[model samples]
Target: MKTVSIRNPGMSWDIAANILVPPGFDEGKRYPAVISNHPIGSCKEQTAGNVYGAALATAGFVVIVPDASFQGGSGGEPRWLEDPEQRVRDYRDVVDYAQSLPFVDPERIGMLGICGGGGYSIKATIIDKRIKALVSITGVNFGRLMREGFSNFDPLGALEGMAAQRTAENGGAKEDINIFVPGSVEEAKAAGIKDIDVLGATDYYRNRCPAEGAGTRMLVSHAAPAVAWDAFAFAETLLTQPLMVVFGDKPGGFGAYRDGMEIYGRAASKDKELVVIEGWSHYDLYDNAVPTGIALDRLVPFFKRHLSDMPAGSATNPAEANH
Candidate 1:
């Protein structure tokens, strides 16, 4: 595993990423690659994205996990601001860097987008054909989540609030409104946070996955565009690549599970599969040992089947090879 920085010209920020090469990697031989993307307000070191990269490297693929532009170890101004389109472009830029590596096979590149990163990955795949296979782990549509609060509670109210924030921003008010972070589990519970998304997120962000640059906040002005964006805008038409959607089926995870299934339904790909990891919350899919271990197992075979060719001398079928 090695950490490196790459320049992203237009965004005015350098992307810092962690790369993992398969054991016994050789410059002479090309290998399939996977670009793993982290969630909004998160960095490459986050649990799901980096863990998957490490696991995939163990399974014979080169994996790179990067901090999105303008966040974490990456460069950019207005530090915690979220740009939907720019984030999508970041994926393409990462792909460009990945393909430049001596040991990476340009033709066999794939991506896994975790949480909000999943939305950007979907858009990136739609726009860039270089991404061959796609995986979304507990993916969320941030635009929708921004316009309509998680679980679709009072969507109109959310949008109205965004309008107010936009007005204040236009008047030169700089306010960063943080969401989903409660000082303690008891506070989150007291705030009527029954949904596992917020509850699980609060637990992970506060206790489990702490990073110096990470916070549960976004610039107030980030709302307007996020509300206008859509991760699945063209899924019913343009998303034609092999797709895999994994979600947790436990109590706190149903919303994401249902959303992923909808994406599977809407995707034009005939080769899509939805797998549900039972008995875990949404955040459990992030770093919890047992469930994530199961997820890595499912991902390895799916990626291998799509990203590599059949072994040169191996049998296509037992009977045919014997005969």
Candidate 2:
């Protein structure tokens, strides 16, 4: 895997990314590629790159794990702004970058997104037909989650507060940044936060694996765009590409389980599958060995069947077969 910077032509910002080519990669031959997007407030080095990115490369595909613009190593002003529209566009920009590479097969590109990235990936695939196949793991539709409060938290009230904060920022006030998760599990418990998703995220981001340029923070004004955006909008009509929605049975306050079911029912893709792992929570799918292995087991074959030039069940690359 090698780190590279991809410039988003539409936004004029550079997206820092890690490109992982299959083992014994041959520049002379074109290979199917997959764009793996990280969760919100997470960078390429976390689950996107360190986990699935590495796994997919070994499974015989060129993988591109990119940090969302305005966050992590990507270049943009007003850092930590989580704009849903811009995040969706980031996929298109990465696709453009992937097509430019000599060793990548543009026609066989697929996408894999985890957490909030899953939502953005679905939205991106709706408009961008170049993404021929998609896999959404623990997909969270942010707009739906915001519209409906999480654990009885008032999102509408938060939206109003964000509006006032945006107005204040416009008038030379200091920017307001909000923590994405509790500082620690102890703090979360002390504050009476019983939401499993929130607690799991706190543990994962703060304890299990801490990555540079990745943390639980976002601009307060992000609510303006995020609250209004819908990642699964028009999915019933435009989401024609092969899709796989994987989620655990344990429902969390974040609504990934609900979103996964909704997308599975609404998607127009004639070729789609919904894989539900019993008992696992949203965060378990991130890096846990057993659940992650189950997800990859389904994802590898799905991508191979959809992205490869060979017959659906046939192994396209000998290296991938060994994995």
Candidate 3:
């Protein structure tokens, strides 16, 4: 495994990426490639993305895991600021960089976008033609979900509020409004689950294990109002490339697979597919472990079948040709 950054000319930025090549990577055998996108507000080192890359590597494929722009390990100021349009560009730039590698099969590339990344991959397909296959798991439409609040599936809206707020800033008004971190009583109920009461919770508190290294950079509260724009629509384009959608049937995860299935229904290509895991959560696919199998097992054959034949001959017996 190696970590490298690809510099983008326009962004005046370097995109941090981690590459994993299993044993015999340099043994004169080129490998198929998978570019897996990480969740929003997360980095390449996150559990879900790392496992996907590692699993693919074990399967004899090269995997490139990158910290999504403005996320961990990647460069961005005022950290965690969300940019929908820029996210798609980052994916394309990364894909381009991956293709330029000496050991990559340009035509055999696959994209895996999970949770927040799922939406980004859908957006990327509309713009990035290079990806031949895409598998989205436990999807999230951050643009929509983030509009109201983290746990609320409200479509109440943020555009008008954002526009009005922007005008207020131009008019020179001051205020401090922010959404607190997850695990509030109301939040738990909003997610449609029973709440675990945390005693003496004046600020952000979790009932689970000690929440360390997590801070509320409240400035991101303006996330909804400022980001009030149309997120990329996957069902709109109907990607012709091979597609796979996997989601856990567990709560909060139900919508993810369903959204993916709805989009898959509209795929222009007959090569599209959708899979639902009976007893997994959105975090389960992230490698929290309900079982040992990978979400990539379904992916390997998806690429092998669609990527076409090798550049030359492999089935032919070079040693017996003289006979």
Candidate 4:
């Protein structure tokens, strides 16, 4: 596993990465690859994305982890702004880079996105066909979640706030910097949910870091009113690629699984599957009780089963397998 960097288009912006190649990777046989998207506002080193990538690499697929478009080591202006359209473009850009590699089979790339990234990955699939199969962890439909809450029927009362936010964006009002990661004092007070302060919300956020609180990145601001952006109902036939959606079974994870099931069930592709982890909460999939290895094992096999067309146990390397 070697960490590398690539400069993105037009500005020589560098996106840092960790690529895991098999021992004989330089022998130059094209292999399948997975581009894992980290959590929103976090780097590639975050718990969910890289850990998942490493596990898949061990499973014999080449894995690539690029820092997201704006935060961490990647390049973007205004620093730490969470723009969904830019994110979807970043996912597409990663696939473009993946397919260009000499050892990557152009037609066999897949993607696995964690948390907020899960939604972006789904959106990316709508535009890029290079991604053959996809997996979303603790999948979050920001559009759905922000609007509908945990229950599909209960939308977050965001209209007035969002309307004000839009007014501010248009210079009709002042910027309310308090609504970045949700559950603000006003929001929490209005909703009457418990532990709604910064430290409290951050405590929950830190727990999802793959590297013991060392791998997360975010900024606090109303960078987007993403509540209005629902990737679903975009187009039924658009995502013709294969998809394998997985999430934990507990309360926080329920909405994701629900959306995953609904998306997979209605997707135009015949190749789709959804796995709900029994009794696990949303954060567990991000690394809680079980180590990264165990958590990742649950995900790697699904990618292996779906992404690679090369026969298992075949001479995967050039001469070693042919003889």
How far off is residue 180 in model 1, in Å?
3.2
Clashes (candidate 4): 3
Candidate 4 ranges beyond 4 A from true positions: 10-12, 148-204, 207-222, 289-298, 310-323
Candidate No. with top lDDT: 2
Q: How many clashing residue pairs are found in candidate 1?
A: 0
User: How does each model score on lDDT?
Assistant: 0.79, 0.88, 0.62, 0.64
lDDT of 2 by residue, 1-323 (tens): 88899988856679999999998999978888999999987899999888899999999999999999889999998899888899988889899888778777767899999989999999999999989999999999977776675313676787788989889999999988878888889999999999889999998999987898795678886557787789999999999999999999999999899999999999999999999999899999989999999999999999999997543323344334324
In terms of TM-score, the best-performing candidate is 2
Error of 4 at 100 (Å): 1.6
Better lDDT candidate (1, 4): 1
Q: What is the TM-score (0 to 1) of candidate 1? A: 0.89
lDDT for 86 in candidate 1 is 80
**Model 4 pairs whose backbones collide:** 47-210, 147-155, 315-321
Off by over 4 Å in 3: 27-29, 147-157, 160-238, 291-294, 308-323
lDDT: the better of candidates 1 and 2:
2
List the candidate numbers ranked by TM-score, top first. Answer: 2, 1, 3, 4
